[model samples]
Target: MAAPLFLLAPPRSYTSLINAMLGQHPQAFGLPELCLFNVPLLKDLWIRASDEMSNEAKTRQGILRAVAEIYGGEQTAATVKMAQHWCAARQELSTGLVYQEIVERLHPLVAVEKSPSYTISLERMQAIRAAFPDARYLHLIRHPVGQCKSVMALNEGAFALYVNAIEFLEDRAIIEPQIAWHDLNINILNFLAEVPPELQMRVRGEDIMENPREHLAAICRWAGLRDDDEAVEDMMHPERSPFACFGPINALFGNDPNFLSGPTFRPHKVKFPSLTKPVPWRDDNQGLKPEVLALAHEFGYQ
Candidate 1:
């Protein structure tokens, strides 16, 4: 079985677009947010792990779509049902085993996936390393301001709240997305410390948006994949990916909804925001925390 490639990044960090783009490589298969590692066993996916978040069902959608497409050759209502049955058969197995089964099915084609949810905890990522020790990791990053702003824009910062990215004042608590951003990136960094240096690579999301072909080609070369004109061109069109759009209604989301609606990639320069400026989402007019600024500097962001 081919060692799969995993994209490690916080939510709203351009992971969806980049994962789809990398999957478009002829030698790679892009999968939806197979959030399998978020739990221990396949059955745990069905069980609600948190009362704070109500979207447990959404996390399973990726595997359903993946299984439906891989086994049935399409994602449809009937196929999703088939996927459910497939999971039912393996409910007793470890999530790593289940993920390996899917990767085995995609033999020769590198399985590429990014489940932002996985970044919420270091243990989930460690599970991936335990499963595929030879796996390649791409540490995708975005400017703190850009990522925090995008986080707040989506569902009123629900993900931040889910991760306990909160700040308590004298009276009330407010969602603090920058905390999630800093901590998730920290989780990724700590996990990568155990991975062999050669098996990991880091890329700025804004740099990729600025010049996809150049960055994609670099990634292809590092992954021992074809980086020729044809392969590079194919990677530029993330929209061409099967999972780029909404799957069957039953398994509707395996990715960010915004990306699902507009998977098309247009080449443009990404404008980064100032790190010292008062964040737009905070009414108190405070900027990023010192730790966030320090981490952002480590990621080459000003």
Candidate 2:
């Protein structure tokens, strides 16, 4: 079995679109946000890991959609129901083992997946490495300003709150998405320190969006896959992937809802905001934290 390729990044970092595009490769299979490693046992997925968050049901949808598509050859209400049964049968198994089974089922075709939730904790990432030590990792990054703004735009920064990325001031605490952006990237960096250099890579989301063909080809070459025109052309149409669209009613989401609504890829230049500018989401006209700026510089952002 070909070891899977994992994309590591925080939420709203172009992961959904990029994962779908990579999956569109003929030799690769793009999976929705399996989020399997977020818990130890398969059954733990059904249990809310935190009282602060209540989106456990959505996280399980990816595995269900994947099982439905891979086993039943389609994603429908009936197949998703069957997937529920599949999970129940192996609820006691380690999530690592469960993920390996899925990878084995797609042998010879590289399994590509990314779940932003995985970066919330280093332990979840460690579990992934334990499961597939030989797996390749792509650490996808976005500009702090852009990423934090996008986070705040979605559900009023729910993800930041879920991760406890809050900043306490003189009298009150405010949702600070930049903290999440910085901390998550720090988590990814610390984790990647343990991975062999040859098995890992880093890329900016803006670079990919601005020049997908070039970046995608480079990624393909790194993974030992064909980087020919034909392969690159196929990757251009991420919407063609089966998981690109909404699944059955029983399992409606396994990825970012925005990506599912419009999986089409359009090449365009990405605008980068000034790191020192007062953030739009802030009421106090505060810019990025010093640590956040330091990390942004490390990521090659001005």
Model 2 alpha-carbon drift over 4 Å, by segment: 49-54
In model 1, the clashing pairs are: none
Model 1 vs. true fold: TM: 0.98
lDDT score at residue 272, model 2, on the 0-100 scale: 94
What does candidate 1's lDDT look like per residue over 36-70, in tens digits? 99999999998774532349888888999999999
What TM-score does candidate 2 reach?
A: 0.97
- Predicted candidate 2 versus true structure: per-residue lDDT over 151-265, tens digit per residue: 9988999999999999899999999999999999999999999999999999999999999999999999999999999999999999999998888887889999888999999
* Candidate 2, lDDT over the whole model: 0.94
RMSD of 2: 1.8
Q: Candidate 2: lDDT of 228? A: 90
